[model samples]
Target: MVQSVKPNPQGGITVTCDNKEEHFDKVIFTSPLNVLTKVADSSLFESSKPKTPVEYLGVICLVLITKSSLTPYYVLNIADKEIPFTGVIGMSSLVDLDQTGDEHLTYFPKYVSANDSYWKKSDEELKSLFLEGVSKLYPDFDTNDIVSAHLHKAFKVQPLQVLNYSEIIPDVQTKHKDFYVLNTSQFVNDTLNNNSVVNHVEKFVNEFKTESNLQ
Candidate 1:
């Protein structure tokens, strides 16, 4: 894990990882924006901080290993306000049966804001709540078919777009020459996903190469 990152006056940025120090001409930070705020040294940025104060949504995903598939569709978006989960992702529908060891894999994803009460729920509570919601949706789904249940939670899953986002978004280039902030928060017109990430990185690489040549 990276402990700290500071700019070296001579040249490059000095990074401290696991108590050891190393110098790098450039640092490409791809982790979540919140991580950057926590790990980066105050002096690393030109103004002591980047102007990226963005809110991120969290997710609590419950994975169910079942004897039979729940839905034929790969994804079931829950439109009802009464439902607990935002969407149901049928992993089994997308993956081959052999890869799942002949079992069905389903995901119940619930997105939560920072102050959402779902964060306080224990594993058992979440299981009960999720299964209850699932049961209501698919009456034919049997509890006996559930081979195993797993809960996964991420506090910072993705950035939530806010008002005047374009004006306040963090730049790829920081005041400090060697330090750059590149993350999902920079995604203005595109959705946050694997494809967008790859495209963004490729775009950044091309631009950086051109800029480096000019410099």
Candidate 2:
């Protein structure tokens, strides 16, 4: 894992990985923006960082393996604010049933902030709440049909867009000419998806080559 990144006086960049240092002419950061703030050395960038720290929302996912199908629809979004789970995804409906041995797979996802109370709940508590929410969605939902269940969590899933968000985004090229930051935080007027990521990379490559006079 990359431990930190610092400026090299030899007109390049120095990156420390697993305690060893490596040199590079340039580096393109693709990880979550929040991670950069943590890993980057204070002396790495000579310019000021973002005035307002960008906030991000995390996610909790409860996956269920069942003996039978739960819902016919591929995806269901719960608009009602009272529900604990925000969305239900039927994985078996999208993938081939044969791959899952004819069993059904479902996902219940909830988006929450870092300090949300949901993070304090134990596994059993989360499972109970999610099961109750699922039961409300399908009154006939049977607990006996569940073969197994798993829980997953991510701390920095995506950025929370705020007022004048685009204006506050850091420039691709920082004060240090050899260092650059590129990630979803730079995305404007586009959804965060594979296509948008690919497009952003392509544009950055073209612009960088022209600006640096790379052959």
Top candidate, metric lDDT: 1
**Per-model TM against the reference:** 0.75, 0.72
Q: In order, what lDDT does every prediction score?
A: 0.83, 0.82
125-159, model 1: which lDDT tens digit per residue? Answer: 99899899999999988899999999999888788
User: Where does candidate 2 stray beyond 4 Å?
Assistant: 5-28, 40-48, 174-182, 193-215
lDDT per residue (tens digit) for residues 1-215 in model 2:
99888788887888999999999998776667667767876655433468787787888989999998898888787877768888888989889989998889999999889899999999889988888888888889888999999988987776777888887766544667778888777787677644677888999999998989963
| Candidate 1 residue pairs that clash | none
User: Model 1: what TM-score?
Assistant: 0.75
Give the clash total for candidate 1.
0
lDDT of 2 at 209: 89
